[model samples]
Target: MKQFREEWDLDSIYVVDSALYSSDNFQQLRQLRWITLVTASLKVVNILVESLGEETFEDIEVPGYRIASCCSDYGGVRQRWLVVESESGRAQ
Candidate 1:
């Protein structure tokens, strides 16, 4: 990300899978002012479920993020997508 900003003079938005979702990675990205759109892991979904307890996604609020979209497979598994942006990006 630093290279992209300094060398290429580009602002990059990352779309990463659950495998890359970690507290350390999130902190690094936040520190660097990079935005990421990621697939929410089952662990994250579970935490939301536990916290909300029967409430819908619309009621959830993540300090630096907005729920961009969600999809579910009622027949089988469920998946969620979350878009995380910086406070600066939220203004634009």
Candidate 2:
């Protein structure tokens, strides 16, 4: 959740302890919990953000303008990159 931490100033994501859920719908519920948590955190932090397929960004970040997507994906706080995706540019 580095993006949230750095850009949005959010702390770690909530622990969804899927194992604790013994219901048949545990998987679905766990996934939903993640979505709800991230969405709520964004709103609560007052970041001008949007949730597309994945990866939240500043409201002004475009689709292909070379984004430094330090998407600290939390489950919500796991980040997959120390840098961003770019062929010849820096992380946005």
Candidate 3:
């Protein structure tokens, strides 16, 4: 991400697989000020569903990331989605 920013002078967004989902990776992305759309794991989805009950989606705020959106599967396989943007991008 740093290379991308330095070389191209551009902000970036990454669509990553579930394998890359981790607290450390998230922190790194936040530090880089990059946005990411990550595939939520089943455990994560289950927890959200249990906490949210009937709600399928919500916008949330975190310390360094703006959780622009979150949604759960209402049909088909159980799945969850999250669109996380760096706090620096919030104004834009």
Candidate 4:
């Protein structure tokens, strides 16, 4: 990210896999200005399911896909956890 900013003078948002997830890593990332889009691991999802219940999710329709999201916090930062649930992933 430092190199990207230095070389291209651009701020970046990362779209990463669940492999990058960890409590410490999330905290570190929260300290930076970079945005992240990542899927929550099943363990994390299960915790929310158990605590909040499935009905807490609200549907959001993006251009091509549907997302179910809820108010949540990650690494002390308030954010939403989203899940895709569209078959064709198209707004039809």
The candidate that wins on lDDT is 4
TM-score of 1: 0.36
lDDT of each: 0.45, 0.35, 0.48, 0.55
Residue pairs with backbone overlap in model 1: none
TM-score of each: 0.36, 0.18, 0.38, 0.49
Cand. 2 Cα-lDDT: 0.35
Worst 10 residues of 4 by lDDT: 1-10
Residue ranges of candidate 3 with Cα displaced over 4 Å: 1-9, 32-42, 55-92
Model 1 whole-model lDDT (C-alpha atoms): 0.45
Residue 56 lDDT in candidate 3: 38
Write model 2 residue lDDT over 1-92, tens digit each, in one string.
33433454334444544343333434333323232222323342233223232353332355544332445433343433222223334233
Better of 2 and 4 by lDDT: 4
Per-candidate clash tally = 0, 3, 0, 0
> Which digits, one per residue and each the tens of the lDDT, describe model 4 over residues 1-92?
34543565436565655565556566555634543455545466667645654465455655444556666675566766666655473333
C-alpha positional error of residue 55 in candidate 1 after TM-score superposition, expressed in Å: 5.9
Q: Between candidates 1 and 3, which one is better according to TM-score? A: 3
Range of the 10 consecutive residues with the lowest summed lDDT in candidate 3: 72-81
Question: Model 1: residues >4 Å from true position, as ranges?
Answer: 1-8, 31-44, 53-92
